[model samples]
Target: MRLGLHALGIGTGAEPAVIRAVAGAAERSGFATLWAGEHVVMVDESDSPYPYSDDGTIAVPADADWIDPMIGLAFAASATSRIGLATGVLLLPEHNPVIVAKQAGSLDKLSGGRFSIGIGIGWSREEFEALGIPFERRAARTADYVAAMRTIWRDDIASYTGEFTTFASIRVHPKPQQRRIPVLCGGNSDAALRRVAQWGDGWYGFNLRDVDDVAAKVATLRGLCEQVGRDPAELRLSVALREPRAPEAGRLAELGIDELVLVASPPQDPVAAAQWVTDLATDWQ
Candidate 1:
């Protein structure tokens, strides 16, 4: 199994130089990928429940400057050649599909096909409101958006007429190096699993605490793939480890996990945090 690191909770105080240095170090340390997280805007701390945490609170610095993941990945792409770039979970329904497809294609082309898109429907209702997207019908909208993006990626001239999106025949140039850029869906719901089987090249397991659960989910995902007439082996299994434990690695591998990404905790010093990730990558290997 390949070991990767998720650059989460890393302070936003670091300068561009620090970001590039850390990303390059990760690449040199033989990490398979460098992943990052995103949250466009945070609402005032209220009763809004943070989905990842039990108490419904975000653990990271709310005042810390936020950077766009696409732009950050682009910077990382320029800094490293081997390490793949990914958005731990890009909220698809929150953005325009056309723009996203174009940007993603550009990144893939520029990165020499070393980009994997991990997407989700998003959990924050406040974020949806802030983006001016309705919370209702988000799942359907996300599905159509993904379908439209695939059309844009695969066709020389793409046109789509959907309930939420419509476009005429337009040529999307500078096609990606990969015929089909890998789409990895993240979520643990049954609907999320179905989406993975229907549209994703892989399924990303989030909030997964144990390997037995991962194995069972993999079985379900495989069954869904078979039901959809897709080859089960074509579906990759990746899991996000909220807390890294060495013993869990073997169990994850046994559960057929291809990649394991450990979330980073905030460090007192940004440089120290980056170095910590570098050390973890080296030690994990």
Candidate 2:
């Protein structure tokens, strides 16, 4: 199994220099990938509850700097050669697929086929509403969006006439370096599993506390893959670890996890954040 790191890069803490330094250090340390999260706009803490956290609150500082993950990864890609660049979870339903496909293809082409897109349907109803996208029917929209993107990426002249999206035959320039840039689906819900089986190259899970539970989820995912006539082994299994619990790494590996993404706590300083990444890489490796 490959070990990697996921950084929130929250606050004014991660400047360009620190990002470059951390990317270089991670690539040098033999980490397989460097992942970052994205939130176009943070919701008002008082009105919107964070789904991932137990307390229904935004954990990071309200003033934390938020950069576009695709742009950040593209910048990091220019600084590192081998480490994979990925969105920890890009809220796909919020953005336009054609534009995303263009940007993602450009990044993958520039990165020499080292980019992977991990996407989710998003959980913030307020953000969706504010973006003029209906909070309901997000899943269906996401499915069509992904399908359209796949058509755009793999076909020469693509045209999608979906319920939500319509485009006449068009060609997206600068095709992805990889024939098909890997799309890894995020979330553990049944709909998410079905999405993985239907379209994703991998399944990305967050806050997986139990290895057995993960194993079961993988089993369920595989069953869905079988039902869809897709080979189970072709679907990569990736999980995010909140902290470095070395004792659990072995168990995770034994569970057939292809990648383990370690999430770092937000740092107060850019240099400190870079050093924290270096230290974690040194200690974990």
Candidate 3:
């Protein structure tokens, strides 16, 4: 299985030197991808229940240094030629689809098609409210947004009509080097799994408990794929392991996962973070 590193564009990893060094080290050490996550803003206090933790609160402080994932990955791209750069999950419902498509296409073109997008219908109600976007029907919005983006990417004179977006006879330049930018949908809800079946090139599961959890979800995804007449094998499966019981890289591969992303707090310094990459790659092997 391929190994990836996450959180490279949050907190200390947001530093330019650190991102460059870690991305280079990961590439040199045979890591397949470098992942960054984003939250546009964090509220000091909110009723939003953090789904990944036992406690209903996120571990990140409101004032943590959070870089925009795309911008951070663009920096990483300048530093490394081979390692794949991806968003662990970009909150799709919070942004305008046309803008996202432009940014994504530009990045992909510059990066020589080494970029993939992992997107999610955001969970934090407060963040959505802060962005002046409605929290409800986010999944539908996500689907519509993705469709609109794909249309922009695929057609010279793109036109799309959807519930949340509409455009006509627009041409987006500098198309991605790849024919299609792989879209990995994030979340574990039935709705999410269905999105994986219907919309995603893959499913990206975060903070999953163990191999068993992955197995169950993969099975569900396979069933959903069949329901939609999509071949299960055609979809990539990536998981970020955060739980103590999370299995080793080999074990995750045995369960048909294409990639295993190790979620760890990256060091602040470039040298230290590069060493961190080498050490994790060594451990993974």
Best candidate (score: lDDT): 3
Error of 1 at 112 (Å): 1.4
Clashing pairs in 3: none
Instruction: Give a tens-digit lDDT track for model 3, residues 114-142.
Output: 99999999889999988999999999999
* lDDT, candidate 1, 132-209, per-residue tens: 999788889988998888899999999999999989898887777885778888887778899998878888787675
Residue-wise C-alpha lDDT for candidate 2, range 155-216, written one tens digit per residue: 88999999889898899978999969899999877888999999888988876656766878
The lDDT-based order of candidates, best leading, equals 3, 2, 1
Q: After superposition, how far is residue 276 of candidate 3 from its true place, in Å?
A: 1.2
lDDT (Cα, 0-100) at 212 in candidate 3: 81
Model 1 scores a C-alpha lDDT of: 0.79
Model 1 Cα shift for residue 202 (angstroms): 1.0
* Candidate 3 deviant stretches above 4 angstroms: 244-247
> What TM-scores do the predictions have?
0.91, 0.92, 0.97
lDDT of 1 at 19: 67
Collision pairs in model 2 = none
